[model samples]
Target: MTAPLLVTGAAGFIGMHVCEQLLNRGLQVIGIDNLNDYYDVSLKEARLARLKKHKGFRFFLIDISDRDAVANLFKTEKPSRVIHLAAQAGVRYSLEHPHAYADSNLTGFVNILEGCRAVDAEHLVFASSSSVYGSNKKLPYSESDPVDHPISLYAATKKANELMAHSYAHLYGFPCTGLRFFTVYGPWGRPDMAYFGFTRAILAGETIKIFNHGDMQRDFTYIDDIVDGVLKVFDNPPEADEAGPAYRIYNIGNDHPERLGYFVETLENVLGVEAIKEMYPMQPGDVQSTHADLTKIRRDFGFSPTTSIEEGLKKFADWYRGYYKC
Candidate 1:
């Protein structure tokens, strides 16, 4: 068996999926999450309940910002690798609760870093976001592209994570990989996401807001695809390359950017319902489009996102119906 892994935010949407994947591969996992009610605590608990069934999995209800708790976890578990997914997410929510972002994203991330350093983890993988490519207007955002200007505090935190990881990689000779995930959606997805909200509104026969008059586009990646990509990267850690900073950043996204209207239409079709559309101006801290350049990941690690939106939406709809008894 390989060395055990530590996954922060194990009860979260992405973290839960990652833990499941790890357990399925017969890997030992130690998951940690605060179970904060950023959304629904029940959903987070549900994710934890599923992970508990795996004998190879262990969980701790510790907030990442708790320095002592986080450090103690690393000392006890001694996990060789770490996947830091715990963060204060959501762009709009960041505007309302700015301090939450600092506490979770900044302070929490620092705690994770200190843990990784103390444990001398083999590789550290953390979540980043496409929001870091804020207002680029570029067709395909690449790791090589500059990401200095972040529109929202959430995006800024994500970008800061990359920088923080890079500094550690350089200073400690630690191998760190930062994944800038795109629009990840599917079963057990976050309720705050647009696709999730859209599904609920359409089902309730409520009008769904169409920002930018549906002019926006996103690389709506599936949760499974994201998990697969993450696992692949986890298996292959970046070494101290001469050019790359002993740290690597990959954009984990669907290379195909689908129109917002088209995505909503696909969801509606899967649900067998038409959504009441409400046209609106672009909200603050919102980007018009996001397209990822997957060349680096594809060439180096054979990373490819295979799920199309139609097929993905159908699966999501099925899971939603069964999960919610809709």
Candidate 2:
């Protein structure tokens, strides 16, 4: 019999999708999440309700930062593999709530590492972010690029998690992989994200803020592609080498970057409503552009994202109208 897979933040956007994919493959899943009020708690519960119908899925309402609680759960489950996705997310929110980042990203990550160590999990995969590329002059951010200059506290904590996981992999013998995701969007996406916010404002006839005077480009990856890439990496754990730690980081994103102006135009076309753009200077902790170089991930895991902005936005628009009944 196969061991159950442990997924943190199972109530989150990507978490819910990942758990569903695993369960559909006839795998047992044990999910844990505190379901904090970072956004609407109702949305989180709605996501969880979908997973509840699967007999192979079980959930625990717990925070990863609670060290003792995480330790106890790990001791009980002792899962063979774990996917840690629970973190205090939001680059801008980190500016206002710095402690939240420390509590979840730093402390909570360490607790996760200790839990993995306790159970001798074969593989530990976690979420990193493209924001860690932080003002790099390089065109397309690569896995080998230097990430020492993170502009936001959120990015800094993600970079720190990579280093922390490396130490654990080196000290122990388990494999660890960090996935640096670009702008991920689709149905059931975070409301704070620009795509969702733009749709809401366009429907309400409100002005949407366009930062950097609309001189931005993002590698807008679709959520399905992200899940596929993640599952591919999970099935193949790294082998420890004598030269370095058994830890690898990959940039999981759409290779194509869409211009911010074009992105808004696509959304406008899909929703059939023109957005009132209020051009403004780039805010602090915001970068001008992001593009991912998928050489390593492709070479290693044979994974590549294949979703276009037009198709992805159309799917999102269809879901948005039905969800809001607008």
Candidate 3:
């Protein structure tokens, strides 16, 4: 029997997709998630149900924050590679629940590092976010850009994760790769994301709040594109050199950015319902725009996001109507 690859947050939108792809490739997979009610528990369960259909996949209800449980799982499973994606995600929610960020993003990440060390994992591929580019006025965020100033607790935690991962890779002599994902959206996406809420509100004939008064931009990369890039990165680990440890960071995002109003209009068109828009002031801990420089990812892995906003939203809308029976 072959050892399984471990994936944290296996019930999550991105995690579920990654797990499914791995399973389809005939790889043994061990998935773990706490099933927290960060959003609707049913949705997570729905995702888990889909993965359960694959015989190559196994699951455990474990929280990454629990040090002992994580250590024990590592000792038992001894997975050669780990894809860590579980974390307390949300910018606005982080303001109200600051402790959640510290507990999950900070302490939980350390536990993951320890587990990797215990198993001598070949590579650790983890999720970072475009939020870490906070306060940077630069148009396109690059891997070499300075991310010292993060406006939200969520972004701060993500930045900290990168630093933490680098330190662990340096000390433990294990390769680590961090992917900084931009505004990702598609079918089975996070409900907290603006696009998801916008779809729901549009279909229900409710008012959709446009933050920053509809004056913002986002490089909304689709889910399939993200999964494609992730698998490519997972297969290739960085080589160690005299200058630093075997660690690398790349931005996985669509190179093109769309305006906020244009995005809403596109969504409205896709859902066949015009939303009642209400412009709102700039919210705290929110940036005006996010654009990713994908040169490194493209150069290294030949990654290119092919999904357009219109096409992606249409797929999401079709899934939404069918899933909700609306």
Please give, for residues 223-265, the per-residue lDDT of candidate 3 as tens digits. 9999999999999999789989999999999999999999999
Residue 183 error for model 2, in Å? 0.8
Tens digits of lDDT, candidate 1, 102-219: 9999999999998888888899999999999999966799998889999999999999999999999888887899999999999999999999899889998998999999999998
Candidate 2, residues 109-177, lDDT tens digits: the string is 999999999999999999999999999989899888899999999999999999999999999878999
C-alpha positional error of residue 235 in candidate 2 after TM-score superposition, expressed in Å: 0.5
What TM value does model 3 have? 0.99
Off by over 4 Å in 3: none
Q: What's the CA error at residue 303 for candidate 1, in Å?
A: 0.9
Q: Give the 10-residue window scoring lowest on summed lDDT in candidate 1.
A: 237-246
Estimate every model's Cα lDDT from 0 to 1. Answer: 0.92, 0.94, 0.94
Model 1, runs deviating above 4 Å = none
Candidate 2 stretches with Cα past 4 Å from truth are none
